[model samples]
Target: MHQQLPPEQLDRLICLEARIHKKSKEEIIQEQFLQIESEKQTDENDRNKQNMDSNKKSDDLKCSQNSENSPQKLFTSQNLSPVQKKSIITKKHSQQKKKKKTKEGQQKDITQYLQYQKKQQKAKKCEQKLMEYSIQDSPFKNKSPLPSDPALEKQLKEKQNQIAISEIKIKELETHNSELRETISSLTEQQLRIQDVVKQFAIENEKLKKQQLQVQLQTNRVRLGEYVVQREKTALVDVWIDGQELREAKEQSKRLEVLKAEYENKKKNSKNKEEQEMRTLNVKLNFLIKEEQQLQETVDRLETEKNLHIKQLKRVYEEEHARFTKNNDYPLIGERYQVLSLLGKGGFSEVYKAYDLQELREVACKIHQLNSNWSDHAKQNYIRHAIRENRVHKELNHPHIVKLYDSVEIDKSSFCTVLELCDGPDLAYYIKKYKCFPEKEAKLLVGQIISAIKYLNNHKNKIIHYDLKPQNILFHLNELKISDFGLCKVLEDDNSKLQLTSQGVGTYWYLPPECFHMGDQPPNISSKVDIWSIGVIFFEMLFGQKPFGQGVSQEKILKEQIIVKSQSVTFPQKPIISNECKEFIRGCLAYNQVDRLDVHQASNHPYFQKKLN
Candidate 1:
């Protein structure tokens, strides 16, 4: 069978065969030329041999004639000598011998030439046979009659058979290649089908996983329901216990009232003056003791009732919280306050417009939610600060300062301080809206702010509002009020300096130059720090931007402050601020703490003294 080969290999084989055939043809042509030369040589020798034979024949004929003529002449001439006859005979014999020798040499030469011609003919025929054999053996030769060489014919037939078999093998290989291609296509189709099956299996697996998750969630819900039922049972038990405690407290209060009435009657019936006086005093002391006991019982009952109410409120709150969680709403506070709307939000506190049920007034309730993420120490510190804020606001009675109505602990995690809600937006809102305030208006606002700051600084326990900024200043009916006393520090006396424990406590833009320190311990600053902040706000109000400008980062600001020491504060001339106003701002923003104006001095500046329509 023919073995299939690459096209290049097949072409290479064909070329090799053609080259071999051409080489053979060349060798055959050369051999044919040699044979032709031999034939020519043989023909030339035969011709020469023929010519020599003819010449020899003629010579022999001439010699015979000469002999005949000599005999005739001798017969005619009787007077001839016997010696002449003998000499003639001798000459004739010698001539015949020479002719014979010559004839023998010619015959020998012809015989040798004939034998050589026969050999040449045989060699020529052998070369013709070899040429025919080569032509027959050539694989590329066209089909034709077989040559006389039997061995060559046999070889040619075998080679033809091999070529036919090779063709058959090539056809078979093509068929096999087609079959293999079909097999490969079928395998690819099967692989695609398998991939589709795997995709379907993956989808089914995802559905099964979702089902499992749903079942788990259902189980969790069932557990939660059980827990709620248990909580309700516990609450009911607590209520019963509180009721029993309330009844006992009421009984004790009734007994104390009876003993007090009896002691009063005995005092009225006493006889001797000194004894009566002594008895009256004793009765009075007994009545007072009984009253104290009754009050204690009442307090106990009230505390128990309060606790029960708180528990009920907590349960209600949990239910509300669940419902509100879906709507993303705030949880209800205690029954005393109803949240109206969110007023504002800060990092640690959220202010809400809430209606106070006890006071029957709308108040701004600042709620500080105790974050669970904070460390214990941080939470404690925050709580202390809140308490301090409440205390500070309670002590302040100034008109330009925000009033604290009440502070309530809503829960362990949260507390609410109800404050006086301002009638207008904060100074920051106005600054944003107007870009910059009118000089007159700014002066009025600054003056009010200074008045409040002065009040805090002049208090018996001098207060330093370290976190003073436009955002912390609220406007009520266009009157400025200083609020947010969370960072307020109360000094022992007016002469005492405020020692800061923490750095970067307030807004960076408003922080004084001295506030930025290099050590772990914060710098000890004075009330003039608030003055510097006032100056910054004053500059912002006049120039529509901070004195140091905006967009730069806090680190850059701190570095600038450290390097320039507040000397970098620039006053622009675009707004045409009066010289007095500029000097006043400069005085407040002085780099040296001693050189900086106090709140009292700032409030009485020539800028604030200007009359406004």
Candidate 2:
């Protein structure tokens, strides 16, 4: 709309957008058809029911009429119908089938429980008898014959002496029984405390069980509804097919008869009318074709003009990427340091290649959005970014990570991030230039991002790369560096802070499922959201186009596509670079987040595995 892009691209977009609109119209038509079919089905059912009622009424009337006109016939025991008996027997059979299984199961469980109880009783009785026998036999008898062997006798004597000493110690301990009882009481108190913890655990377990039960019940209800709808839809489809075939055949016969009659009865009049109509239609068709040719010429001229404008936009955008390409000549804006070019821009700030005369070195300066003085929330968030950027960079000294030079106080009035400039195109621009990047190149870039993510996550820093598109990845001297932490939230860092936000933050075409369903905004995205972004990148690398087309209203576009044709889930409209690549992309973009591979698993994927050096 702004004409920032070329006119031809815009025209193509307009045409493509029209096609999408047509698809949407078709979907509306389909919905209307479904509604009509439902109404038809309802009407048919009502008509059939009415017909049956009418037929029953007629039969009743006929029976009454016959009974009145003639003498009433006597009924006998033979009045019982065979159909009624068979139906009764069938019901009885079903009842017996169900009841017999239940009865057998109940009887088995009863017998098992009774046997278990009897075994417990027997054990108690045996234990009681054994204890009584031991009590009665104790002091008055030698329970066995004395050993005759000299060594055995000596061992026995020693054992008896040890036992006596043990008995004396036991008696002494009994004399100090109050102290022992106090110790036992302390232990018992500890045991009670442990039991209390166990009881708390049990209560928590019960609560979890209830929650699980509710979830399971809801799942069952949904599944049941889905199955019923599917079954009904299948039945209707079959009926529609049969009715369509029958109607076509009948209509063909009727048309043939009509045509035969018309040809025989009104041949001369019909011929004159047809000749007149053909002459009129030919004139109209000639006029329409002439108008269409003129419109096509106008469209072609516009296409050329639009392409020129797009080329201009691409040049401007590439100039920004080129600024990052000139790592040595970073120039800042507004002071003695003229901002040579815009390096990159994000939701928060624009990065510039700035020159510091005093330092006499090129530094990548991030111009703060606060210079314009936005809202308090904006300031706080930028402050958080500055802090996180500093802290994380200071702690993490990975070679893959872009190095932070300093957070300089410019003119004692503003803050600018001075970073070590890297001379390479970002992955987004790289892929755009190359169309679909080779597997080796893609994985090499991905591995670097993985290294950076792992470093962040491993530091117990919960700074998920909330925006992990290819554009954010800079390719510097064969090393990929991740940039832009504007959307990052510090979750499990030393701060121990929690945030719940649902604002659309990342690029829409590359959004995850959570971002899609989390409403009109991005959700309080998890690390899993990064995983989804990775999936998008994975697809982008394998295909020139994104899984969802590059469109402003792509969210809505994809939503429609998913609604009408879920099975058409695919990569770019262009042919695939590889099947393995497609599978890899698909695995990452699984609708169920749990089904997707984690970063580690993804890195080792067969498609990527070969590319890993």
Candidate 3:
């Protein structure tokens, strides 16, 4: 029989043999059919040959048996050894068994060959059907199925039913799994919500506990105050009683002295009568002496009580003052600063006199509060203005420029800028008090201002103090210090001639004509604007009033075009300002920006350069 391929090789041939050998499945199936038939034919032939051989062997064995059974053979067998005779008999039996075994094996082989032929026929028909289906519907199909036999179809149907049931079970399991996941997610969310609630409760509890503590403290303080008041009242009553007792004791002592004098006089007149009177007077004097001793002791005790009361009151006052300072007198800022008093208040900011904790010096804390009511844009502009102020002020280290110590944003709504504290009054207050300044003193002060301005303009980023005014200028130890850079402008570079976006941003009286210029396009502001402001300030110092727009509202100044139309500045007759100073002021207050003196020119002017006579 031909060697059969293993199941793996047969499956490979069925699936991939066509692709490898470039033969169709029909050709491969036909070859396999021919091969199976040849194997069957060979097997049948081999079985028939074995049967024929068995028949021949049987015939030979029958002859031998017949010969052995003959009488002559019998006499020979009897004469031979019993062992030989037994071996002969056993060989005959072995031959018969071999014949029977051959017959049985041949029958088995025939049956197996028939079964294999039947299987091959069925397989051939199935393969033919699969090839037909593949050609008809799916030529390139990898897994074309064979025609269904009844038994195989039944099994397949059962298997499909079982698979469907298993799929249903899998779907149910998936649904259950999804439900479990949803439940787990819900539980986790609940846990998170509970945690958040617990945190809120904890915070509220802490707040309530703090509030309870505060209430208890207030109650205790009230009780302590009542006790102190009662003590003070008792002390006052005791003082009054002591004073009354002291007066009564003094009267008694005076009476005793008067009686003694009377007794002496009587002794001079009548000796016996005077002796009786002297005894009475001596007894009265002894009683008065004891009463005086008791009164002195009471007085000493009263004095001690008075001293204790005074000390207690002083301590109480000190504690109240300390508590007030701790609670209300100071800003909410930590230990960094202690606000002493409000130095000044402006439209958008407040200045407080504060003691710096780290620097151990008094500072002016300018606080800007961004009101919630303000528009978002306004708040942003306010913050940007403060930032610009900090940027410009921090770079300056001039003696006349107010030193910036620290700048901090307290919160979203508050900003603080700490600056050098000027102990003396502002220039406005000084001008108001003196009505005007002497040309000599004004020269000294104005020169300092000009020098600071010169330094500012000469900086890499030219700075213009747009809002220079008497109120913004401060005196620290009688030295002029310029302050309040909120409305100041910074140029890109020294040669930058950038137009001013904020057209009107200074005190109307101090603003130059260019600042008041109204047109389609804003004017380009330079150091000349500051020079005009300096002239205005100098004119005010000498004449005690603004040259162009004194006591004029900004609205009126804009509406009337006061600064824009002014041809020249006029001086007061009573002030009698010198011509040199007047000429300097005129140069500063020139209507045209080009005609206005620059800070350097103004600084080197003969008025400032001249030595005091």
Candidate 4:
């Protein structure tokens, strides 16, 4: 008896059995003829059974017993009637003829059908084997005995070996199919990657082409710009040439007009010579008579004024002499500053050496005396000037500028300004005592002055020392400091042009040419005016006298005629003074303020440069 097997294993066994039992081509044809004959015999048997219907049931029982005895005796297509067989044969033939046109599709369908049939046959065989085993184990054991043929046993072993071999082959084919599928998937992925690379190359190429176009455009623009510039330059040259031609033509026309006017004037003079001479003499005689009368009145007035001034001077002298004989009457200033001694006295103010009680330091106090006889406007003006001076001194913080410690109004009319006290004399006194300064010393002092002035000029609150002179420049511990901002002008932030006040406060000898016109209209002055004064100071330091002679009357200086005349006078031939120093003075003393050297330029002059060495 055969062992029972699972459906799947049995299916594999059936397939192996079919392959092992496969016959030759001639044998296959003979088997097909045998199948047809079996169908015809089955049909005859069916007819006979119908004729013997009474015995058909008994025959069926017998047939069932036979099929149980022999498991191979099962129902199949061979058991069909001749008519059904004929019909199936005809249908198969038609299908084969139709499928012949699609041979590959028909072959795949036939292979799948064969495998399904093999599976069905294997399932039937498994059921038959199970029934056989059940029969052997049944209580009716004597009903049938198992077949004990050695040939059958050998056939079963051979079939089992074939099944194992077929299973191994099926596994190998499955592995090969899986490997082929993986290889196909890998190839597909690689093809997709290659397509992406190609697309990227195309995109990059497009960008590169766009960049090349932009570069070409920029190059064209640069070339066009150069061409435009060249055309403009050519046009400008033509315009300049035209301007030169027009200027020459205008000059010629002006000369022609002047010549024509001269010719006409000469004709008129020739025609009216005697009449003009007679008229000019009469006019001169009348002017002389009027001038004599005016001179007489002026002389008379001067004499009267002189007598009155003499009497007033006598009275003042008498009073001062009497006071001096008694004692010095120094007004008590504020309590904060104790007056030690009188420093100096001016027309409207008095300076005294004092000690600051609060800070315990020596200071100079300048007391302004507002006289009762002064007009309200004059008093206000005086007070305003003092306040401006105080403000400038307080704001300035340079080492070479005097510092104002404090300011106090002692009474309703008088105010005092406490200032830094200097032990040494003023520049004027030093110059008077030494006669002249050495070039090196003068340069150093002048450099310091320039630095102080530069600081004030460049300060946030810009100030200009309009009245810079020797008397206002002081010395302390051999260091020069500029003091007395009484006439300093604070410049407005927006306005560049400066106008001088009506009262000319600066010394006449040191005053610039513009300062002399203060009576008519306040002249627009600038830092260059201070440079002119610095030049005069420099000249006086070198020569011990002013550039214009000290004997030159103030009236002449105010008229500015002396400045014009002094420009022509050659400097005194001194071996100590170099030509560079003379040139420096000339540059600073230029008659036109515009032509004069500014403070910055004067500070950089070679004369000062030598002092650095």
Which candidate number maximizes lDDT? 3
Residue 79 of model 2: what lDDT?
Answer: 64
- Residue 151, candidate 2: C-alpha displacement in angstroms: 81
lDDT of 1 at 429: 64
Model with the higher TM-score, candidate 2 or 3: 3
| TM-score, structure 4 vs. true | 0.46
Cα lDDT over the full model 3: 0.72
Q: List the residue pairs that clash in candidate 3.
A: none
Error of 4 at 360 (Å): 2.0
CA lDDT scores, all candidates in order: 0.71, 0.59, 0.72, 0.67
lDDT of 1 by residue, 295-333 (tens): 785755455444434443444344344322236343345
lDDT of 4 by residue, 1-613 (tens): 0133444554465456557677432344345446545655775686587669848867886877766765445454237888998998799768756544444443343345456667877999778667766786666543564589899878977997799899999999999999999999998788657644544454455457546745753443332211122246447331111123233444555555555565455545655568776566556556555655665454444434333333333333443443111264333356456564455666677676766645656788887878899999999999898887887789878889888888888778778888999988788866665658888788788888888878877788767788788988899989988888878887877554588775446677777677666356678888887788888898888878887748777776766656545543257666278778888888888877778887778877777777433
| TM-score for each candidate, following the candidate numbering | 0.46, 0.42, 0.47, 0.46
Global CA lDDT computed for model 1: 0.71
Task: Report the Cα lDDT for residue 498, model 4.
Answer: 87
Which is the better candidate, 2 or 3, if ranked by lDDT?
3
- Per-residue lDDT over 1-613 for candidate 2, one digit per residue giving the tens place of the 0 to 100 score: 1222343453354456458676432244344446545655775687699789979978876786677653433233236698997898799768757655654454444344445557877999778667766786565343454558999977977998799899999999887897889989999788767654554454455457546755753443332211122346447331111123233444554555555455444544546567766565555555545655565444444333333334433444555455233463333344434345556665456677655544555557776645446777877866776777666665556787777766755553356766767787677665655557766666666667777776666566666667788777787787888876656666764543334373445676666655555444434445656666776786678676676555438567555644223222475556435677667767767776567666666666788666443
Candidate 4 global lDDT: 0.67
Q: Where does candidate 4 clash, by residue pair?
A: none
